[model samples]
Every structure is written in structure tokens, then in C-alpha cells.
Target: MYFAKRNSEEPEIVIENTVVYACESASCNGWMRKDFASENYVCPMCGSQLIEEVRELPKIQTDFNSFK
Candidate 1:
């Protein structure tokens, strides 16, 4: 007897691996990580400015049992 073929899952893609940082005006007190897909990010409180800090984050490789 013949068996049907099984499809395999696609590999995961690591898009952004850096931590984003932003700071708004002292009075505004509004800052957060901007979405990568977004065009412009502005502070909601004071509308000062939104800055992004991109840095290489460490990657850890382990066995499957690591999740346990």
C-alpha cells in the first residue's frame, strides 16, 4: 500500500534581535518600543520624540529538553 506524503513546517525567521529604547519629554512621560513595521512613532504625552536603540542581543542554543 502507498502512503501519502507529509508536509514539513517552515523554519522560523528571526527579524529583530535588538532591544528598543525610547524616552519622551520629562513632563510627557511617554516612551516605548516602536513597531518595526510602523512608519513614524511619536510620544503621546508631550510628542517630544521617539528614539530606537538597536543592539545585538545574545543568542542561546540548547537542546529540546531545555524547555522542560
Candidate 2:
């Protein structure tokens, strides 16, 4: 009997020691890695200013230095 390939059940991956920035506007859901965020800390999608925040999100690997 031939068996078809089955999807592997893997747990979600988590990242550590990350800094992020989130929109300060009350009606926005914008957020990004501080290092990769806009130069002015503005939310590109909502045009709102950003603030430093701690969050758990999918890790994004980038070569750009986030520090100013």
C-alpha cells in the first residue's frame, strides 16, 4: 500500500531580543521592527507616528542597521 505525504505539524517559531515600534494613533494597527521602521518613526501605511514598543511577532531578517 502506497501512502501519500502528510503535512508535518510544527510548533510556531518564536524570536527573542527584538525591539519594535508601533503606531501611536488610537485607530491604527501598524507596527514594524524599530531597525527596519521608517527613519522618522512614522507608520508608512497609516501616516501615524510610531513609538517604541515590545511585542511578539514573526521575526524579519534584515541587513540594514536599525540604530541611528
Candidate 3:
């Protein structure tokens, strides 16, 4: 049996500085993107207060045509 070689190259991931709201509670691991967050900065998981911070995250690709 012969095997064929496949492309081993992996796609490059783009990283960007994104603003987010993170939970202040030490035990809670909750966060949300600033763009999608509401006026209330309360953590939905633990009901703790949220604080603004910047983090390096992978770039998200959005297709506007999908909304229609």
C-alpha cells in the first residue's frame, strides 16, 4: 500500500489587541468583548463587577453576507 503526502503547512493566525471586560472576582473566569458588551459591566456567571482591559486575541473573520 502506497501513501500520498499531504500539505503539512498550517494556516497563520492573526492576532490583534482587543478590548474586553473581565470579571473582578478572583475565582470567576468571565470575560466579554467590549463591542458586544452592554452598559452594565456585571459578570453574568458570578454576578461580579467587570473591568476593562486589553488582551491579545485571534482576529475574527466575519462575513457580512451571512447576515442576510
> Whose lDDT is higher: candidate 1's or candidate 2's?
2
Tens digit of per-residue lDDT, candidate 2, span 1-68: 99998879886776666778888999988888767665887788888888997876666655564433
Clashing pairs in 2: 35-66
Task: For residues 1-56, write the lDDT of model 3, one tens digit per residue.
Answer: 99998879988999999999999999999999887788998999999999999999
State the lDDT of candidate 1 residue by residue for 1-68, as single tens digits. 99988768766755557555454566664545433324566765666676776655544345742664
2 against 3, candidate with superior TM-score: 3
State the C-alpha lDDT per candidate: 0.55, 0.77, 0.90
* Model 3: ten consecutive residues of lowest lDDT: 59-68
- What TM-score does candidate 3 get on C-alpha atoms? 0.73
Clashes of each: 0, 1, 0
Which residue segments of model 2 deviate by more than 4 Å? 1-4, 7-12, 60-68
Scored against the true structure, residue 33 in model 3 reaches a CA lDDT of: 82
Alpha-carbon runs more than 4 Å astray in model 1: 1-18, 54-68
Best by TM-score: 3
